[model samples]
Target: MVDGKGKKMSKSAGNVMAPKKIIDQQGAEILRLWVASENYREDIRVSNEILKRLTESYRKIRNTFRYLLGNLNDFDPVKPIGYR
Candidate 1:
């Protein structure tokens, strides 16, 4: 694992990123998405750039869901709504 500064996370180096801290700031879902999106075949860097991009992605995902839900609020399951 690596720190936000791109340094290897180590206890001796005092550069470890605590899970609780990250969860508290960015939420566990974001952390999970970050981990799941990474390619485990190689070393991963957890820098500010990566986090920023992930945050933006998460926002987009959330907005998409919100838009879907909002648009579906007036739809009835018994009747099919034709796509325009």
Candidate 2:
């Protein structure tokens, strides 16, 4: 993985970002999304900006699902209402 500076993450450089630390800070979903969004064919870059953008995307997706689910909270399969 590379850092925001485009340099490889290394313990000697003090830029290592551990998965457990990221999960503890931003939640496992964020970490998982970050990993999923990266291109497996290339080196992944981890930075504050990338994480911030990913978090926003995650929120949008989750909020959309919540809205759709909320609209179905009172839905009944047996009752078919005519469109107004």
Candidate 3:
């Protein structure tokens, strides 16, 4: 529904990003950061060039998480912390 005018992000458009795609390529963290980086009120565009640049930062985050997980391999948590 482009009347030569830009539209906003919506669930009805069916242009929503798929979870499986995100998990397959970079992982959940990348998708989360990408979503967090944008302003929801404005239109969000997805092009290969943009995704390419974003995925770099995404991969870095994923790598950092991986490293942290590896470093904490031996540690085990007895229970999860609850926020007050």
The lDDT for every candidate, in the order shown, is 0.81, 0.90, 0.64
Ranking by lDDT: 2, 1, 3
List candidate 3 segments past 4 Å from native: 1-36, 76-84
Model 3, CA-based lDDT: 0.64
Quality of model 2 by C-alpha lDDT: 0.90
Please write out the lDDT profile of model 2 over residues 1-84, one tens digit for every residue. Answer: 898777999999889989888888788999999988889788889987888888999999999999999999999999988899
Task: Candidate 1: list runs displaced more than 4 Å.
Answer: 4-6, 77-84
* TM-score of every candidate: 0.76, 0.88, 0.46
Model 2: runs farther than 4 Å from truth?
Answer: none
Q: State the TM-score for model 1.
A: 0.76
lDDT per residue (tens digit) for residues 9-74 in model 3: 356875545667756776766666766776667566653455567889877877999999999887
Q: Write the per-residue lDDT of candidate 1 for residues 2-81, one digit (tens) a residue.
A: 76555788889877767687788888887898899987886776755777789899999999999999998888889976
Q: Each candidate: how many clashes?
A: 0, 0, 0
Model 3 weakest lDDT span, ten residues long: 1-10
Model 2 weakest 10-residue run by lDDT: 40-49
Between prediction 1 and prediction 3, the one with superior TM-score is: 1
lDDT (Cα, 0-100) at 15 in candidate 2: 90
Model 1: number of backbone collisions: 0
Could you say which candidate leads in lDDT?
Answer: 2
